[model samples]
Target: MNRTYLTNIDTSISDVDFTQHKNAVFILHDQLNLDTWPSWIREEKPLLIFIESAAKGKTLPYHKKKLVYLLSSMRHFAIECAEAGFPVYYHSTKQHYDRALKDILSQYEDLHFTFMTPSEWDSRERLRTVISEFSTKVEEIPNNFFLADAEEYKERVKDGWLMEYFYREMRRKTGYLMDGEQPEGGEWNYDEQNREKLPKDHSVPSIAETETDEITREVIEMVEKWYSGHFGESEDFTYAVTRRQALYRLNEFIDERLDEFGPYEDAMAQGKYDLFHSQLSVYLNNGLILPKEACDKAEEAYKNGNARLNSVEGFIRQIIGWREYIRVYYEAMMPEVREANHFDFTNKIPEMYWSGETKMNCMSECLKPVIEQGYSHHIPRLMVLSNFSNLTETDPRELNRWFHLAYVDAYEWVVLPNVLGMSTFADGGVLASKPYVSSGNYINKMSDYCKHCDYKISKKTGEDACPFNYLYWNFIDKQRETFSKNGRANFMVNMFDKKSNEDKKAIFESSADFLEEISRYKKEQ
Candidate 1:
């Protein structure tokens, strides 16, 4: 049966009377709400339009699965809307956004079209421009998924855009760690406690496996067919696609692993894909799960004696602290924000990012999981892969695009703020206070990768030295002038100034060689 042809027979209003009243079109992805629809429908009885934009298809990389995931999810959402007493017009176009809108408007001459604001900057801007031509009113509704409403967050953080301050405020307001208005753990953050590396013999519980449904299986087939020439492996494409499944996964993480999540949240393991980390990001990003619900569940677990306050607070901070903060920062500084580049670094992304053949054990292992499973925990993403990209002076846009393409949870609204802003510091200091660059020592301390790596983690020069060691110094030397003015980077500048010119040159030359070899290996694959 062709699911696309399924219709709501009871609400089958005819095309003949479509132009009779003022119609408003609400554009929605699967991640958006239907409750947002009826209010608009009551106001105008508008023909709800869901478009799979050709622009998105063109802009995304060939190998990126985001297009397929988004389209299929939207299609599923559209089918649900049709069944729920709503008149929906679904359009899949290859070209001309105007053509689609014009065609729809021709059918309903007096249609006063309006759509909720898109989370992505590009989509929002494009729709805003196109909708300006219509004589009717176009109102953009506020997105309510976040705990910190945009206007409220902006007003609350008037002193500065610092995340720490904002996070503390949220903690106080929500009573996340409060014991009757006082902090429960005495300290506001357990960041010191959370940085412990996993013991060598530490055992991680097996990740739960999910079987793909027929719809998901079809989506996987479509991705394989269209994206065969793209980078990354095509196997084992399992992700939660609905709210119920996402909730189940969340519960399992809280009940089974939340107790240990705090102490080893930043630790990485060679063969482990999830080590005390919640892999619910893809679901949260796509609207399958809400942040509030995830946070509330963590709090509930803590209260029920299933988890510790440290673990629950740590988990809540990711959503309420970093995630919400990044979104607010993105909205506040976008359009101009995407163009920020403090170091003015413009090196091309090396091919090793696609093929996991690098000598850097952290990068190799992290990329392997990313290519195979379309996922990696936060620490690997922030500290390993992203750190390498920044240290090697890869073009922030290229690195940002690669991250957006490769990750299962990559959406522009989420990925752009994280990759360009937080991870890479490509947006200067607007998102992150400082660049997250680190030497091989950081990797060695965090994981067991250093033990098996051929390169010496302690060495800064010569053939046996880790590439990250040379790259770290080279990155600092290259960006000294840019970082000197930054108060947070003063210590790094002093360290760079201590190195002799000859030693600096040697590190620079070695980094160049490492980057070249990595690039060649990627092209060969």
Candidate 2:
């Protein structure tokens, strides 16, 4: 199993004269866009180097489907580069990246390596270590995969660190959904018009499945053989591996799902995993589709009257506003952000998260898609999955790793800010204003999950009560001082204060017992 899968096919040159072709471009798994190639690379057609480290793929017990998606995509891109008349040296190896690069360096003389700055912090550090050793041969450029300007973010964020301010600044800068100096439709955000629950009569568009070609089939077989006990199933692996397929999915989303995407963007339901949400994050996070291109297509849909402004604006906000802002936020808050634990919750993760077996209907429903397909829309992620974690005081770091391991779209840059900052409030109000914990009533209002649950949503205390009800109050009472400073969350603190002494005691006891139960469940597992 430690055997490496390495291949090198130089289409342009058969000879191995490293001094003749001194310039080379190295492609990472995430930076797969051909159009983003530098002018020198396009003109000179320098040697293309791709390293597929199996050791890197198994760094976190990554979902088997994620493994297939990433490795397949890399292989497909390598073929594309070969067809495009570039000499490719593709390395599929179980060896560490540094050692692999060292071997490559040993074989070549006066060969220089240029790569796009890696998206993840650890990847950057590893590259830095290699660059330090080969100072004359290796260099990197700023990653253009994202559209946010760090300088603009710093200038706009002087007033506050909120996303809205940064989002508006990006709107003005990009002129996306903008009319002259003001926002299109006289509004900056259409989120208020969104957030409607899924109606019974409403139908969801079917998610487009990518057909497995020979390369993907080979990858699935390799991943199954290599990663047997990883997270999610790889049997039904069907994700767009090439740029053409990713664009097709984007167009399909715009044509069928974009119009209704605004209203039901946050809605979740039983048996409906996608619900009007454009599952383009997988494409966006990887380099299959650029942010500007996707945003432009959505804007065109709005202009042509094919999609509503609310839907288009909402989709654009996710790209330019939240996604880009989070990238910048991650850059600003790393090393420290990784270890940020404000409430310092030391509890271990529950068994139910991995097994997807739980009496809680909402948690089970949300965790199902993640375990089966390595996907779930944003609402389920923020409300149900991370909500349960925060309520149970699970370590935010463990939950972050689970998100990275469980979701195909998860990268450290996106997952860390979201899990530690937004979801769990582990950064002490740096990424999110407050903890995103909520009772079962919110879940009931959003979806029909509570109506069929074992624990009564109406009950606020006792053994049969929904655990979220007591856990929310317990979190509020424990973090009263933090909530009191937060103007928006202060009302929840007042409500918890108004609870009678007996009710307070019942809430504390229920939360305590439930926490113990999950902890014991973890121990048993």
Clash count for each candidate, listed in order shown: 0, 1
Best by lDDT: 2
Provide the overall lDDT of each model, using Cα atoms, as 2-decimal numbers: 0.72, 0.85
Q: Candidate 1: what lDDT?
A: 0.72
Candidate 1 off by > 4 Å:
1-25, 35-48, 62-64, 83-85, 96-99, 110-114, 135-137, 152-160, 499-506, 515-525
Clashing pairs in 1: none
- Pick the TM-score winner: 2
Residue-level lDDT of model 1, residues 321-362, one tens digit each, is 888887777676677766667677777777778778777677
**How many pairs of residues collide in model 2?**
1
